[model samples]
Target: MSQKPRRQKHPKPPKNWQPPPDDKGTILVRRELDEYGLNIYEFRVLAHVARRESKAEGCYASQAKMAEVCGISQRTVLQALKTLCQAGILRKEKNEKGRTNIYRLNEGSKWKHPSELEKIRKAEESQEDELLNLI
Candidate 1:
């Protein structure tokens, strides 16, 4: 009997990504944790949440589940989750049963990407210069 290869929980994207046939959308998130200056663990949790979410609906995963996948304790997961929340990258809702919390990416958040920092800085400088001129 031949054994089949086990499925990976997290699979890397292919070298060349081709759009889906129907163009519904792609959910393959292989983003680096530091893309937005986020901590690695926190971003891992964020990625996990994003993986489970759909464009139409925000999704939730249990702390235990995240911990199990990330090889960390529930406490660590919670801490990382909280960090993401405070950074405006994630929003959490307590489940009614109190088993675990539901998390979703705050995609509408004011949090700017690293690439936007320079543009924001320049804007602020211009604004300050205008203010100085008025003064």
Candidate 2:
């Protein structure tokens, strides 16, 4: 007797497909962000920043801290931070006490919002103009 072929297992749909509405409250696991080009590491950092318990004390963490928590190298954390910051998912700030950066979630940031990107571009242009005038 001939044996029948076995079927392959299908992938499961994501439980949480939508991005979190606000960055202040608990953030939804943004699986789509990954699908849209963000890697797992970058998504994790975004989630951590979004779920930060405190903002006054600088809820943002350093690359070293993120590396330790995520079990990745400091270089990887830095790379992820750059990607998230460029994507408008995170805001980076220098810690007053040290050189380490503190990352915060840009709660109002929307990937599809052209105004936001325009604002950033305008700010960069203004800075460039100021520098040129200074020369």
| Segments of candidate 1 deviating more than 4 angstroms | 1-34, 55-57, 112-135
Q: For residues 42-133, what per-residue lDDT tens digits would candidate 2 score against the true structure? A: 76666656665366855556666676666667766776676667667667777888776676666644453433444554565687689899
What does candidate 1's lDDT look like per residue over 34-124, in tens digits? 4566556666777788878765556656777777777667867777776666556677776676666677777644454556544544565
Q: Candidate 2, which segments miss by more than 4 Å at Cα?
A: 1-27, 30-35, 110-135
Q: Please estimate how well model 1 matches the true structure, expressed as its whole-model Cα lDDT.
A: 0.66
How many clashes does each candidate structure show, in the order listed? 0, 0
Clashing pairs in 2: none
